[model samples]
Target: MMLPLILLYLIGYETRVTTACSRLEACNSEFRTGLEVAGIQEPESSAPYCAELRAYSQCIKKANKACRGDLSFHTSTAVIDSLMKRFKCAQQNWGPPYKRPSVKPKSNSICSHQSNSEYVHCGIFGDPHLKTFTKSYQTCGAKGAWPLIDNKFLAIQVTNMPVINSSSATATTKVTIIIRRVPGCAEEKTFEATSDAPLRPFFVDSSYSTGPEGSVQMKASINKTEKVEIYLRYIDTTLVVRRVGEYLGFSCRLPWDIAKIREENALELCQTGCPGTELLDIASSRGHRLSWETALNKCKQDMDLETGVRNNLTDQYLDWCVFDVMTTGKNEFVSTAHLAQEDVLYMDPSSLRNRTFPLDLNGIPKPSSAAISNVTLNLQVTAVVDRCGRNVVHAPAYEGAPQVGRVAIKVPPIWENRIPVL
Candidate 1:
């Protein structure tokens, strides 16, 4: 579903200013309680509410720094001022109301990752950039609902929405991850998050830490008002879900041993990237377009972690930062790039250093442009920009990299991290 730009802006304000918003709500509750004590249920003439109205305005003004990132909070004092004008506190009385819009987190979930040395990183964030298990990166629109990972261990799905009005590009807005039931490992628990909604820190059943103590059980919540991390320690996998502005961003780290390719799970977005129809023209587009120069300058200036991030990553992040700002037309969106890299450093340190393929790495042919245009190309990460600075990506057409097909074929026995499912 396409969200209006105005709504997106409002939602964005609520995100960064969550703590201030919380304090404001608490103040509102206190004021309402005061009114109740004075027997003024709903002040008819605004006389009883005038004092509290002024107080509310003060509260808004005081929280200006705390909610500086939230444009909504900036207008709140103005809203009260207009309300007082209409109420005519000088003639009678005026004040803030009892109820208003709120999105408060009751119990937030935190992510704790059990680090694995040999792991393949697959991350999707900021207008939905895709980095596959094999280290191939592609920025495509995986719109609608698609399984990020569908296998015996887990089933993860993400929903993508158009980034802005008049743009075909999309960013993830919601994520629903199901850690399938395994007797020794963890219970079948689900963790879901959306851009505008409060996060569900615990499982659907409300029980915490279902897995055996010190065993492969579901761990605790990891992060904050903008990010949530769930650690499937049993499988040695870490899932990173974040809210960047009005859109959701997601990434995962899977152990190389468990990063298996089976017929049933071949079509997962983590493996196959987005379908061809969801392909976006990041290079050339009139709507929501930015010149390479403009986009580059914005990233260099706004991406605070540019130097540190450069050591760990390729120009991929700058590209994402540039794309995100252009697609959303909001400079704040550049932070998503910083957040994604920070997520990687925390989630998969090896990925930041270099590629993590443990097998015959040299034998495996990496997919790239011009070769797989005719063949069904799956993943495309790095692109060779031409003279016009057009970002062009092509799949690696090689025998080593398998194709997506319905043929049910036998597979070679790979190492398995088995926890007996009793």
Candidate 2:
């Protein structure tokens, strides 16, 4: 985001002022020494130099106030206070009349190295000089002093082959390719079950489409000697593919799963039913019964940790099946839940007007002895689920020390029966 030219200038000016203030004593040592010598025997409150001191202090305060009020500048109150103190001391020591020193203006120029032979001076918005500079550049370029030309190239890269199957008699592969107009545009294309000769060489033509101006078309064709099936599936498809780079190269072969579910069928399954409820029904039909609440809770918990659950069951299944135990591969009762006892801490009058507290290393607040008398800290034992949720286990409650002044309380984690069963 570009800032207004006026704002940029103000920012630069404020920075220079701050830099000057940092070395104020060295910058005006003679004036500061005069103030010190004149106020040696006088108390600051009734000193003869008090008037001059007040004037300097007020000047700094006003400047700092203006800096703070300006949205374009980020002023520090601490720095301003320090500057006021120093200025006041200088003024107090220099009794009698006072004259504020004039501040010099800094240069405001924006330049860049455009080429080996010439440097470019740019003009910002709201500056009349910018218009003149722009016209000058145009006129100069028209005379070929700085000519602009299109020297960019179009590059194509094959990203992925989600589906690659090769049998003794037939070969099939699905490929996703990315076309990039160097320094300009990009597009993705996917081909499904398109290549029958997976190993055959192919030619990609970069200048195939000219109907649409500035659009680069990539045309891939297999060798004439090879028999191939090329079917374009564009960008939208059921299979999930991540766009990678402008250039990548890799090849691999593995046993193809003939029984693998089709993308359309997998999508349909997710769209037709509720995730946990459908899974529970499937488990019950297979001789394993489970409560709807238990299954639903487990599914919700897992979904919360992963991406949010989708409305359609087919999408939910496709998204969660690989990570969830109930729907992935072979479903089984992998774990059990148990009830456990643990102590929990509670704070009284949960809301407090003051939040700042003197906290110890453990983050427990230390209140005064008198305040502690009225503060309440209690430990209550509660039932929680064990890791596996199979048996009951008694454990001490976990509670941190009480915080003083702070009304906010930190709630400890409560154990849950996370083991999903059927």
- Model number with the top TM-score: 1
Worst 10 residues of 2 by lDDT: 337-346
Off by over 4 Å in 1: 1-117, 214-225, 289-292, 302-314, 347-422
- Please provide, for model 1 over 255-372, each residue's C-alpha lDDT reduced to its tens digit, 9 standing for 90 to 100: 6556664455378877766777776645432235555456556666532442222222234666566667666666555667766765554444333323211121112233233443
lDDT by residue (85-203, candidate 2, tens digit) is: 53465444445545545343223211111111111111101000010101110000011011011111211122122111210111012233232232222233222222333432222
lDDT of all predictions, in order shown? 0.55, 0.22
Clash count, one per candidate: 14, 16
Q: What would the TM-score be for candidate 2 when compared with the true structure?
A: 0.16
Best by lDDT: 1
